[model samples]
Target: MSDQHQASASVSAARALPQLGAWVPGYVLRIAYAVTAAIAALLQFPLGSWLYLALLVALVGALRPRTLAPWFFLAMTGLSMLWAPPNTHSAAFFALLALGHLTHVFAARMLAVPARARLQLRSLARPLLHFAVIQATTQLLAVLVAVLLPGSSGASAVPLIGVIAALALLALAFVLITPLLRHERRDERR
Candidate 1:
C-alpha cells in the first residue's frame, strides 16, 4: 500500500479507539453479575447462583447472536427456573444491560464509518471527539443508574477502578472483533 493509504489506516484505527471502548460498558455489568452470583452461591442461594449463568448466555448472545440467541434463551430460562418471580427481575436487567451496550456498539460503528472511508487524518479527528462524547454520556448514565438503583453498592473508588478495568477489556475486545464483523456485514450487503 502507498504511504497515504497506510496513514489513512492508522488514522482510522486511532479514531476508533474511543468507540471501541464502548464495548467495555456491558462487560462491566457481566463481570459484576458474576461477582454477585459468586456472593449468592456462598450465601447458599441456589437460584442466585445461576445468575452468572444467565449473564454468560447474555454475553454469548452479544458476541454472536446468530449462533447464540437460542442458546441464550434456553440458558436464561433454565437459570430463571431456580429463582422466584422477584429474582427473575435480574434476567430483565441483564437483557436490557446487554441491549444498551449493543446500542453503544452500533453508535461506535456509526462514528467510525466516515473515518474508515475518508483517507484524511484530519477528517477522523472530529469523529474521535464524538466517540468520546458518546462514551461520556453513557458513563454518566451508568453512574446515575448505579445511584438510583437500590442495593447497587453505590459508587466508590474501587468501583471506579472496576469500571476502568472493564472498559479496557471491552476496548480490546472491540478493537479485535469489530473490524471482522463489520467487514463481513459489508461484504454480505454488497
Candidate 2:
C-alpha cells in the first residue's frame, strides 16, 4: 500500500479500538444495581426499605428472566400503591415492590446492547426515557385519581405515597428495560 493508504488504514484501526474497548452497558448496569441495592440495605432508613427491596428484586430478575411472567407484579405494585387503602404492617406491599423492581431491571438488561460498543449510549437512552415517561404519567394519574375518587379520610396523603411508589417503579423499570430495548432496535436495524 502507498504511504497515505497505510496511514488511513492505521487511523481507521485506531478509531475501531475504542469501540472494542467500550464496556457492555448491561454489565455496568448489573454492577450498579447490585451496588445500589447493597447501599440501600445498609442504610436502613425510611427510604431504605423501598430502595433495598427494589435493588434485591432487580438482581434476581437480572439473573433469571423467564422465572417471572409479563412483569405484572410490577404493574400491580404500582397500581395498588396508587389505588389501595393504607394499613399497618403490610409486608405484601413491600414484597410486590421488590418483584416489580426485579422484572423491570431484567427487561432493561435484556433490551440494551453490551457496553463498550459505540451504540450503547443510544440504546441506553430509550429505556431511561420510557421509564421517566411511565413514572411521570403514573404519578399524575395517581394524583388525579386520588383527588377525584371518594375517600374516607387522609385523601391527600394516599396519592402522594402512590407517586413515590410509582417513581421507584419507574426508576427500576428504566434501568432494566433501557438496555434490552436498545439491543432489540439494533438487531432490527441489522
Candidate 3:
C-alpha cells in the first residue's frame, strides 16, 4: 500500500477507536442508573405498571440529569412504600435503602459530570463514606424504632420515619454542599 494511504487508514482507525471508547462509558453509566432506579422502584412497588413507570422515569432521569425527572423518580419510589405491606424483612429494607442511595448518587454524579468523562476510584471515596454514615445511622434508627414499638403494625410509623430520614439527609446534603457553594461564590467574585 502507498505510504499516504497507509497513514490515512491508521489515522482513521485511531480516531474511530476513541470515538467508540467515548461512547461506552456514557452509555454504561446511563444504563446502570436506569437499572438501579428501576430495581429500587420495583422493590418498593413490584407491580407491572409500576415497573413501566419506573423505567420511563429512570430513562428520562438518566438522559437528563439536570431536570426534575430524577426527583420525580425518587418521589415515586418513596410514595410507593406508603402502600407497601408492612415490611418486616430487614434484608429487603436494607437493600432498598442501599439501592435508593445508589440511585441518588448516580444521578447526582451524572449531573455534575459528563457521562463520557472517566471517574477514578478515589473520586468516589467521599460518596462512599457518606453512604456508610447514612446507612449506619438509618439502620440504627430502624432498630431503635423496632424495639420501641414492638406492638405496632409498623404501617403508621413508616411516614414519620421517612420524614425524619428525609430531613436528616437534607441536612447532611446542606452541610456537604455549603463549602462548595462558598467556593463558587468566591470564584465568581474574583
| TM-score leader | 3
Model 1 segments beyond 4 Å from truth? Answer: 1-118, 153-190
lDDT of 2 by residue, 52-110 (tens): 56555546644543445224335534554556554312434333334345446545564
- Model 2 stretches astray by more than 4 angstroms: 1-15, 18-25, 32-58, 65-106, 111-119, 153-190
TM-score of 1: 0.24
Residue pairs that clash (backbone atoms under 3 angstroms), model 1: none
- How do the predictions measure up, each by TM-score? 0.24, 0.42, 0.69
lDDT for each residue of candidate 1 in 1-190, tens digit (9 for 90 to 100): 9999999999998877333321233333333333433333233224454555554544554444345443443434433433332221243433433434443333333333431232333443665576567667755655565556556433233244445767998999999999999999999998
Model 3 lDDT per residue over 29-58, tens place: 567778899788767776688778887888
Which candidate order results from sorting by lDDT in descending order?
Answer: 3, 2, 1
- Between candidates 2 and 3, the lDDT winner: 3
Model 2 vs. true fold: TM: 0.42
The top-ranked prediction according to lDDT is 3
The worst-scoring run of ten residues by lDDT in candidate 1 lies at 80-89
Residue 11, candidate 2: how far off, in angstroms? Answer: 10
